[model samples]
Target: MDFFHGQDSLSILEWTLRAAVTFIFVIFTVKIMGQRAISQLRLLDFVIALMLGNIIAHPLSDQRIGLKGSVVATIVIIVLYLIGVFLSLKWPRLRKAINSTPFPLIKEGEILYKGLKRARLSIDDLLAELRKEKIEDVKKVALALWESDGEISFFLDPQFEAITPSFYQLQTEPFDLPQTIIREGRIDLSVLRKIGKEEEWLTHTLRSLHHTEVNNILLATIDSQNNMKVFLYV
Candidate 1:
């Protein structure tokens, strides 16, 4: 019994070592792979991620397999991934084979049933995604595309879109972008400096507006027109 217990304790220690090594190896691999490897993953990248999870998990729990084997397997997977990325960048045909192209879900205020069927998306799912974008009526949409990454991009009809000064043939003066001076009860010194305004000036301005405490302000902005907008916390 003592011999078995000693073996189990040694197994536990081995497992810990395996987990730690695999954890560090995965982190290093992700860093080398770059952000797009995880984020904005295409179908091929998604499959690889799933397979890699299974590959890493097996050695992590199994004490009989050596950590060196897991490390080697991981490195091999990363190398193949890098090679695939290079090929995808160089060859458009190969890229198309690995990742799906965007499909039109709607065009000219009309739902494309054929496109929806090809994407394997139901009307309810499409409507839910549209609602998330605050689009309730389908007629208001001029074009909607189901992106390769499974996101829906909406383009409103010209009539429904917000009218800009350009529509009226107006010559608008170029202005500086608005800078946030305060956000979430905190003063942004970088934004203050960017707007060429000093901290003392802000304090004085706030005081002039009967705002004695900066923390009391929830949000503040200085627009290109030199208009200072302040919203206080309730």
Candidate 2:
């Protein structure tokens, strides 16, 4: 079946060329707009991207590009951008009057409820970002700023620590797990050598506990207190 229905249809080659041109145009247009397309996007940047995407899409699918349609749209977007930039520079008071600044959500380990209210952020929203950094208690957070781009910047206390799990109270630090020296009745000789210990030291330690063979041990660890914890099968 002929899809074009006798209309002057574009050959595959023509379609490929048109698609390539459109792709390049869109990429170049986006590049000209700066890195705001990905990072630190404000309300105006978002609106322009949406409108530009729509304008670019319409021409690709539509059968006709009228004499003045695309040119008019491009000119309008450029004009608006230039006007915004010009006005922002020429009149600082006007710019500040229009675009609001970032509000402080927290300061010195205290939540600014009034600022949160003004920023339209709930306690839950604030807590969620805190939780992302595995911070259960907000008391350890020194300062948290709500950026103008709607991102939360966290400044944690240097001495902040997470609450340890019940079974792992000795594990005060996250990456402080002790290396196993003995497991399932076998001596981890490699571990012993890595820690600068020898078979004689292991044997002497075992002799003190009335055991000579590693096979009798079920679990052994160098605890955080710098003590060897040996659990033997009874």
Best by lDDT: 1
- The positional error of residue 190 in candidate 1, measured at the CA in angstroms, is 4.4
Candidate 2 runs further than 4 Å off: 1-39, 64-67, 158-234
For each candidate, the alpha-carbon lDDT, in order, equals: 0.73, 0.66
Q: Give the alpha carbon lDDT tens digit for every residue of 2-103 in model 2.
A: 322344555444444443444445535654543323346654455457666776677778867542444456556655656766887799785654344656
lDDT of 2 at 142: 86
Which candidate has the top score in TM-score?
1
TM-scores of the models, in the order given: 0.68, 0.46
Report the backbone clash tally of model 2. Answer: 0
- Lowest summed lDDT window (length 10), candidate 2: 1-10
Residue pairs of candidate 2 with colliding backbone atoms: none
* CA lDDT, candidate 2, residue 217: 81
Clashes per candidate, residues 3 or more apart or on different chains: 0, 0
Q: After superposition, how far is residue 43 of candidate 2 from its true place, in Å?
A: 2.9
Q: Give me the displacement of residue 37 in model 1, in angstroms.
A: 16
The CA lDDT at 45 in model 2 is 59
